[model samples]
Target: MTPPPLAADTHPPTELARVEFTALTGERVERIAPISQGWGHLSWTVRTTSGRYLIKTGIRRPQQADLYRQVAAQQIAAGSGVATPIVVAVGTPDGPLQRPCYVQTWIEGADAASVLPRLGPQENDRYASALGRQVAAVHRIPGPRFAEDCAATTTYPTWQAACLSRIGRLAASIEEKAVLPPAVLYAVADRLKTLTDQLGNGIVPRLTHRDLYLPNTLITGEPAGAALLDWEAAAFYDPVWDFVKLGMWVFEPHPALRAPFMAGYTEFEPLPDGFHERLTLYQGIEYLAAFPYFGSAWPDERMLASFRTLLSGWMDAHGLVGARP
Candidate 1:
């Protein structure tokens, strides 16, 4: 989805004072700059006497438990040797800050999305390989049941059921919002049903970084590797979903990086059987589901037309054709 336009780097005086006092904890607040890229949250890069930190305040206050769960997931990934931000403090609505917020030690680096495209071929390959290795490390951590670990209300005994439930929710949202044409939705729904049927049983769930795209990864010189950011979407899911995301958001658009990333990933864990087919199915599902998010942000007819073109490409790749009901 195209990112929303950045809001000005201004904060209400009262909120700023409260956040500074609460998060800084007696340290002097040097600077507070708005992070304009991400969706659904207001983030600031805060500089203080102690160190630089990231202050993330929800655009709408999230459930307090959900905020805490995100912190827990970040801690778990960091513990597993993944380079994730350390949660510093959390603020609640009852606190001085009205909105739910968390502060974390900010890792200094350029966003991989910008850095990777500008690098020499060798360096680009190196960075992609590093990212793949880091991702694999995160997946190795054992966790509670998929739903319970993430504090999701629903639970499913099988991966297929959970996936279908998620897709169904996305489809419902798209339909209710009138995000895409009925023909496109019908084709995607049909393909997803067939794909679900083809999924094998006994799939084991692992901790997945559900949104592992280039923008969420940081490239640093000190550590000389890729660090993952934004653990809010972390959950217990089929490991294939992570690979699917990597392919869709990174490798598919930048094919040169693919071989190195796969090399690093397979070095740690070998690809399972029928990986390509499963990845393709997931790509289609992900693109279709993403319409609700993108449509809500960019509601223009041109954006809708772009969505249709992308969906058509996905359907064609999967040998599915749209038919109006």
Candidate 2:
């Protein structure tokens, strides 16, 4: 996968972050160190008299409300028995600090991506299974009766309808950008319409951690479990979409990892019929939908080429070559 461009650090300086941290938590910061793995947020591991905590700020303005919402989502996930970090305190958007921020208890494990490759076959499977079960647990949370609008003011009758509507908007955005070639854009439009027709309605909606790839999970020993991080992208949507993302980003590329995750998830909920076809449809939509955002973030030739290559491969695999609206 092409790496996302590193967002410039718009966060306050460490001393300033420390001052705000002290003001919010009422404890002096003993140490502050940056966490380098993330791309979108500026975060630091902060040690204080109370405990070790994570201090995170958005890389851009207008992120305060979103940060607050993310904290709420993490609380919901934790309440559902998922091993997520607890939110300690949150700074208001209009406060003197101006930047919205939050403090959460620090988790103590390396990301799964870093640890998975070092483990033996048995250990890897064990980790994957644990991760799968946690994902299933999150999916068990009941979704809202009404679909959530992007602007947070309206609702749709069904999750599928809401998703199709969103994809339609995304299709228009991508076409306007013209980042993708005409052939690819035409193929994407054809697939989107077909998926909308075939997917239909009345599927039960569930809480989906839309960004639950390998790096977003932390692996630990002894207890042998995974702690999911980054609840910012959590939403109410089709649970199958999460499985498709996991298969594409986590399991499929690494053959040895596939069976264990499936074994764990199937233990909780069985895969529905026509799973592969649905998975293909969702994957295609994801690639196309992602193009606009990723293209805007990283506009260099190499990144665009990488995206084109991925889209071309998906088209070939799905027999979508020469497919046009």
Candidate 3:
């Protein structure tokens, strides 16, 4: 089976080997950093004779092969006033570049996640507002059908199956690494099954980032420029999935995270009915249940601290703890 390519597969991409400069664009590839933690297509930054641009190219072939995702994102961002990387050039991988490529204006500065935790409460709130408004802009993009084009966005029916298959992998990782007790594994499995059951009960779908945590958001304070990049896993699904994932990652049911995210998301106040329960459902089902699967790989303090935070947040949100000796 072919694995997905790094998203935005392009010359000078962060992951793929940088390619030779071509005449089509004057930009020169200056520095490159493998966009780790990103998927589907590889992306990189290029410093040209003119200016910097974020270039992405396609990867090893998949059914949704080519550059539709880039086009769709650029179109959506442009129409909605979202601060997206400006679409520059879209083309087939130039000869040596077997994959398709796309060029967009580079976003300077850092990802918002980097500075979020350190900011003062006011900064945090302001940034959250920026993010909310930015996300709302993208979500507002009009698509005849709101659901993601699976092939275009690196998702498929296989994705749901992969999550299910993760159950055994989670248990094996726990047993292999001995991170937690056997009972804990069983408990996680039980909770996951219940959570997955809620996936499509009402079919009230909305465009979702699917992975809209802080890391993916780029921010500036003056005008507060914010952009949501990397649309590989984005799809039309329960909109709450995005917000809940944000809460889970930021503080694990910490209402602080939800407050601004939800606020900026709407022009007027929108009630997130059953918001807490919905929030808990996603994390308990998604993050907590999947934690054991990574036990073998992410065993250090970073991993430990993250889970400790998760546990604290989970317990605080819903009075549930397992096998605490």
Worst lDDT run of 10 residues, candidate 2, spans: 145-154
What TM-score would every model get versus the actual structure? 0.85, 0.87, 0.63
Candidate 2 TM-score, true structure as reference = 0.87
- Against the hidden true structure, what lDDT does model 1 obtain? 0.73
TM-score of 3: 0.63
Q: What does candidate 3's lDDT look like per residue over 1-325, in tens digits? A: 2334443433243324345334336555666555544444556666766777766655533223446654665655666677766776665644344456666777775677676667788777777777788777666553343345423443324323433555555666667777666675566666665655544434343456677777777877456456777665556544566665665565463457567766777763354566555656656545554455445543455666577566545645554576620
Q: Evaluate residue 89 in candidate 1 and report its C-alpha lDDT on the 0 to 100 scale.
A: 80
Go through the candidates in order and give each one's C-alpha lDDT.
0.73, 0.73, 0.57
Return the lDDT, model 1, position 98: 52
Which candidate has the highest TM-score of all? 2
Rank list by lDDT: 1, 2, 3
lDDT score of residue 25 within candidate 2: 87
Clashing pairs in 2: none
Query: Candidate 2 — what's its lDDT?
Result: 0.73
Model 3 / residue 47 / CA error / Å:
4.1
**Alpha-carbon RMSD of each model:** 4.1, 4.1, 6.2
